[model samples]
Every structure is written in C-alpha cells, then in structure tokens.
Target: MGTAILSGIISSQGSGSGTQEIDLLPTRFIACVRRPESEDAIRSKLPREAPDSTVSVYVKDNCAAAREADVILLACQPHLYKPLLLESGICTALKGKPIISVLAGVTSNEITHQLCQTAKTESKGVYDTDAFSVIRAMPNIASAVQASSTVLEIHPRPQLKGVIATAHAIFSCVGTVFTTKPGNFAACTTLNGSTPAFFAMVIDGLVDGAVALGLSHTEATQMAAATMRGTADLIMSGKSTLDLRYEVACPGGATIQGLQVLEEARTRAVWMRAMAAATSGQSSLKEGLKMSRGGF
Candidate 1:
C-alpha cells in the first residue's frame, strides 16, 4: 500500500516535471525491494505515468538498494524491521543515512537502537550512532490518492533536521503532514492513521440509510461519498461543524430532526469509544514489539 502510493506520487511528479524533477532531490534512483516472485507483480502495479528510471525494483536484495540510496523508506511489514536492520551488510549500507519507517507496531527508538547495535558490531570502535536517524510515520491507505493525513514522529536530534525537512517535503506532495510528539504518537495514529477506516464505516452507514430510503446502491454510495468529501472541504475551509449544522438544520427541519435521532443513538460517544480502544491497542502493540525484541 505504501509502495503504491509513493510510486504514484513519484511517477506523477516524474511525468509532470520530466527530467527537471531530478533537481527536486539529491538522488533520483529509488530502489523498491520485494520478494522475488512479488517483484513482477509490484512493478506491474506501478502507475503508467511513472518513468522506468525513477524507481527500480529489487528482489530480496535490500542491502544493495540501501547502499545506493541516500534516504531509505522502510515500508516493509512491522515484524521485519529488526531482522532487516540486522541483516548482514544492511546496517553498513544504511549507516549515516536517514531511515523512515511506515511500519506500524514498531517505534523509531527500536529501529534506531537496532541500527546502532548493528553499526557497533560491524564497525566496532568507529561507529557513530548519532550520524544516522530513524523517523516513524503513519500514513493511511488514502495516500494512494495523494490525500492522506499523515502523522510523523522524530526525536529532537539536531543531526536529523535535514532528514525531517526532506520527509516533510516528500509527504507534503502526497497530503497534509502533522508532526507529533512521542507522547501523542499513539493518539495521532488512532486519529490520522486509523480514522479513514472509521470514516468508511460511517460512509457505509450513510449509504445504507439512503438505500433504505429507496435510492439505488450505486447512487446512494456516490452521494454519500461526495457529501463526505464536501463536508470535509467545508470544515477545512474554516466553517465550524456547529455553524454548518445550524446552517443545514434550519430550525425544525429534517436535517435537525435526523441529527436528533443520531444524538439519541449516541453516535458521537460510540466513535469516541472506538478511537479510545484503538489508541489503547497501539500501546499494546508497542509492548508486544518490546517483548518480541527482548525489551529493546
């Protein structure tokens, strides 16, 4: 999912700017590593607008890619982060480069510590862990459409300023970016990372409601989605939900009547509970990762 979204952004940018876009980044080659059999499938899914030269796919050969790229994005499954960081030659290749992990259930500290351990083991006395950085980001599947609400977490290491700026630039191309502190990272994940799925559930409910009112499924779904998009746009444009509600309610109107039903059902409280559970689940996930990594 991350690969497809990133490829879409890179590819679309490539087409829009052509060779001129090469100036946007210091390095132009993007290595997308995957399992041997998955290489072809992943490549086939790349956007047609993507130029062949911008991204190269490698099969089971991540070290080579890391060595060639200045900045690396680790979008692999969360469970694979430690092993991959400790892979022979991978730490050496990744030494001094910025690594951005989109892997859930894994913390930046975990990834950074593993990398530091690998570097110390490989280079012995010459290792400088401060030279490298690890950043954790949570971007939803909406990134595929360049409209994700992404949240990023990073330590206040002075050395990582450039890396953070680079990350901001890359993600800004895809969607809005929010920098989150460590304490709030989990909460941000529940809101920014997981809320899209929650919104989808609401959309489904709205669509079902319309269908029950005699609208065809196709028309109902479209209208629900459009309404959602427009409502979000209006909210984004500085219109408060309260103001919008009053605007549509018109005192004793159907909108207000329907809102009363929603209020009676405690829909807002239900969503609040859902997000609270999800945020707690993220803490559990972090604990599980710590246990798996022997309390790293």
Candidate 2:
C-alpha cells in the first residue's frame, strides 16, 4: 500500500495541478521497513533500469525510524499493531506529529489511548495536549497501480488543520477520495476492500458461461473482461448501471431472454446474500474483539 501511494504521488505530476500538487515529491519519500529481508526485497524491486524518481529506503525497527518522520504510517495488521507500536516506543516519539493508521478494525480512540500510555511511560510527565493526530484510511489493492478508490477519516489533533489537503493530494494520485465518518470505516472496508473480489467473481462467472458456449477459456476470459470494462466505463460516464441494463434488455430480444434466465435463478439476490454474509462475519469479529476487550 505504501509503495502504491508513493507511485501515485510521483505519477500525479502528469495529472495536472488541482489535487496533484499536494502529493509528496519523490525525493521526500522515506520508506522504512522493520525486517532486513524485506528491505533487500524492496530495494531489488526499485526501477533502476529507467527511473524518473527515486525513493530513499531505510531498514530499521519501527519506532527508531518513526522518530524522524513528521507523518508516520502504521500499516501493520490489526492484531499486531498495538503491541508493536507500544513496544517500539514510536508513540512517545510522535510528540505533535500525525500518525496515519491503515490497520483494519482498530479505531482512532483506541490508537490514541495506546499512544498516550506509551508517551506517559516514556516522559513520566502529564501532557496537556494530544501527542499525535491519527487518520484512519481504507484504500484497496488498485492503489498499487494508482487506480484505487480510497476512503479516509480524519481524527485530527486540536491544533491541526489543512491536513486533509495533504491526504487528498497523496490519495488522489491513485484514485478517488471520499471523506467519511470514523464509525463508517468498517462499512467502507466491506464495500471497498471486498468489491474487487466480488467483481472478479462476476467476471469469472461470465467467462464460465462463455466457455459453456464452446469458446476457449482464454478467449472467454478476454471477452468477459472487455465486456465488464466497457460496462464499468459506461456507468462511470454518467449512465446508471440499471439504466444500461434496461437499454440492453430489448423487448423479447436475446438479452432479455438471458436476463430472464438469470432472474429466474435469483442471481441478484444470491449476490446480495453473499455480500451480507461477508459483512456479518466481519461485524461479528469486531463484536468478539470488543467483548474480549471488556468493551471498546
């Protein structure tokens, strides 16, 4: 995700000024990794062949490197995040800096408390202000190629303003950015994080249908993919998806015949059920965690 964000920021130079101007300059990126092996792997992946921009990579344990950063990203998995940040002493180092978290199922208030405890332990003094500002964001895999649909929630410190511009510039390079309430992050995760999988399944089903009609697997897949892409483009170009579907369903035509088959099978209801099941499972996990915590 960090690599994706970096790529988007660097590529935004060609995307014109309005939102792109806020992304970090290529030279400003300071990537830090916790493991030595991961550092070597990342360095190997750098575009040494023909590069327009460069990134400075640092290999160190988290907190130590975090001290020098004005904006720190916490990108580890949720279960490991609190313990790792607390143990690394990064929170103590964040004095008045911003800490952006991409960990799923972890709330800003929880992060604030953990950081406050860490800071208190390190300083042994009562601090009157929040030591760090946190922003929780949910960005999908498309970010790797600068085509993500990112959802962000700002939980700014009392003294901070104008941070949204910075975030917008950074995320806009990859795709669209939508401001959402912190409580909605989990729903955003289900909607955005799980969408690609849902789309892929639809594509696969289309390909299967094509293959059943005697097309080769490769041919079917290509045809299905192109059809799906074109449909998406049409929807994005101002036509509602339902409107497009209705347009294709000519009265008693081949398209309508196929639609009848799908309707009889309750295809739409099946997909709705699938999404509800996935969302319910995730919500249940959240509730279980809260119970374990004796209340979140």
TM-score for each of the candidates? 0.88, 0.82
lDDT of 2 by residue, 1-296 (tens): 56555555555544443264643422355677666776556555443431433555677666666776667666655666566657756766776776666666777777777777777777786654456677777777676556788888855444444455556666776777888877777778767666778888988888888888899999898888788879878987999978898999988899989989999999989878876775655544333353321111
> Where is model 2 poorest over a 10-residue stretch in terms of lDDT?
287-296
- Each prediction's number of clashing residue pairs: 0, 0
Q: How close is candidate 2 to the true structure, as a TM-score?
A: 0.82
lDDT of each: 0.73, 0.67
Among all windows of 10 consecutive residues in model 1, the one with the lowest summed lDDT is: 287-296
lDDT of 1 by residue, 165-240 (tens): 7677667666778898877887887888778889989989988888898999999989888989999999999999
